[model samples]
Target chain A: MRRSRTALFVLVLALAVAACGGTASLKGAVRNPPLEVGTLSLPGPDGREVTMKAEPGGLLLVYFGYTSCPDVCPTTMADISEALTELHPDQAEKVTVAMVTVDPERDTLERLDDYLGHFFSRRLPLRTEDFDRLSAVTAAFGVQWEIEEHEPGDQAYDVAHTALTYVVDDTGTVRVEWPFGFSSEDMAADLAALLEEPRA
Target chain B: MKRTSCRRRLAIASVLVVTLAACGGGSGGLEVTEAWARTSPAMAEAGAAYMQITNGGGADDALVGVSVDPAVARSAEIHETVMAEADDEATHGSDMGGGMMEMRAVDRLEIPAGETVSLEPGGYHIMLLDLASPLEEGSTVELTLTFENAGELVVTAEVRATGP
Candidate 1:
């Protein structure tokens, strides 16, 4: 069963790459299955074990990047913030942005906290302990991470992963993930449409 | 005498047109307005600032550089976010980048007139290098934006409090 699942993941990953302009492959490869968003236990930047569950009552936007990421991570979130500004203050309430770290090795609770601070004044930190854990969760949603190469035993790296930001609907299903470089207007429109999805 | 007078007027008119065109967006003649800046915390070795670059006057204006309290930071520069890639097109990180995927600059940071320029995290931003001291929240830092032609405009950046 595991071999078949791995083969399927490989196939999907190949296709995903094709659809993604044949960008670089995702590191810490996982089984790219549709994520079943639900309660999961993970340590947050606060160092406390945080049990986060999917609330179908609202829309969640998720991304996987490390804190030290020079640009891609921050730029993507900043874009999301801009799109949020376009949303009605009331409707914005129904949206939550979740960024999980791939470099949990260095993204200590303190580091994660500091990293998230640049994005959301109130954004809580999301961190994982093991690569396998991150791999499993990210794979479940087809999130890829291919950390760039460097020196031997070196931790610092530049990563190339799926640039698409994930938008999970209230039902815990991966909804549409707006590709990188979506205009602010288009992002707002898609988000509004998703927000108005018959509130489950 | 008449010919010389006409040439002088034409030169003056040309200068005016060029200046006016630049006073807005690019030479493209876009209207610009609603410019604001966020102040970095003073005393901090480094800080960041943000603003809204509305192009009500033009199509778009690209922010290339900034000048701030030299006393506050050794240098102020513009930064655009981008993902790294390798020459073989693999992800470059701690182990890769045999000069492979170099971190490329963002195509452009568009400042559309009337739209707020949110240079927050995960977006276009100004990096303040070498701060004089730590910037405190609620404090304001004076920022001067030198545009291509619209000239230079100084703004106050408001520092917000956050966990260190």
Candidate 2:
């Protein structure tokens, strides 16, 4: 009886280790206490207010950027699209990408749709002119951004914004955060691993 | 008269040598390589190009100006992306609050002797403004870079979906 009990204890220990080790090897920065997605209802390209949600066992890739951004935004969008291509078609279908434009003044609904659709077909274009609501949503995700003051007709103005990408779990909690310069291969690997993790 | 002719021939030969050096012949000179630009999305008014400029000669050089055809873009300017701290003080203590990236126009980019200067993403780049059309993938755009010493060099940048 003693030996049997010891064997059972060892088996239980192994199972626990397997469960915890799954996400510990992720390439992104894992959030200890993940932040909630929090009330991000914005207008999609179709002129309808859409509330962002994460389905169980699925992933949400959120990025903050604008259409006028030439360098960082395009590189990031391409990387995400490439990462999705690296995943299995079924796994890729389980993921959703949403880009929230910090510069709504320049990023109209039609403009955002055209820019984002070129990179990934499975994407959501989130834009809002209500600065107060935008601030609340960005604050929840710990994103920071600023736009240069310019005249109404000034097309050369610039916007200063963060480049961090967030990975939200099925619960709408930010599970991992990837900073600027993260490679597409690493992102794909993280997505595969996150998909395998069991939802709580 | 024969001796004078010989001397004049030598003078002409020396002048040829000087002209050869100035034209970047055998002597090491500026070389631009690996020039590429990311494909611009449809309706995007601006785009950026990146490359490495190597000053192989003994004297330093500076890239003072850049130009592209009006069909490609209205103008090209050298710019640098800088990281600025976010204004949200609430997230100040957290490392996840990555700072904001800002791009500013730079007047000159110096290429020191025997050094290679790279213009890459999140760093120095050539900002193409008022693009007449979207830079399509697999297409090429021509740019003329004016250097203080190396004169003007025409570089063709291949457009791709991502950076190299």
Candidate with best lDDT: 2
- For candidate 1, the clash count comes to 49
Interface RMSD of each: 8.4, 3.3
Model 2 Cα lDDT, one tens digit per residue, B25-50: 64338888989998998978889999
How much DockQ does model 1 earn?
Answer: 0.09
Alpha-carbon RMSD of each model: 13.9, 8.3
Per-prediction DockQ comes to 0.09, 0.33
lDDT against true structure, model 1: 0.55
lDDT of 1 by residue, A1-200 (tens): 99999999999997775554221222211123544655454666546764444454666777777655544555566677777788998777777777787766656766666655655553556777776676666655555566655776665454555556666665665555566656556677776766665442
User: What DockQ class does candidate 2 belong to?
Assistant: acceptable
Work out the TM-score per prediction: 0.50, 0.87
Q: Who wins the TM-score comparison?
A: 2
lDDT of each: 0.55, 0.82
Taking chain A of model 2 alone, its TM-score versus the true chain A equals: 0.90
Write the residue-wise lDDT of candidate 2 on A26-133 in tens digits. 898887766777356677767787665666778888888898888888888888988999999999998888899988888887888889888987788899898878
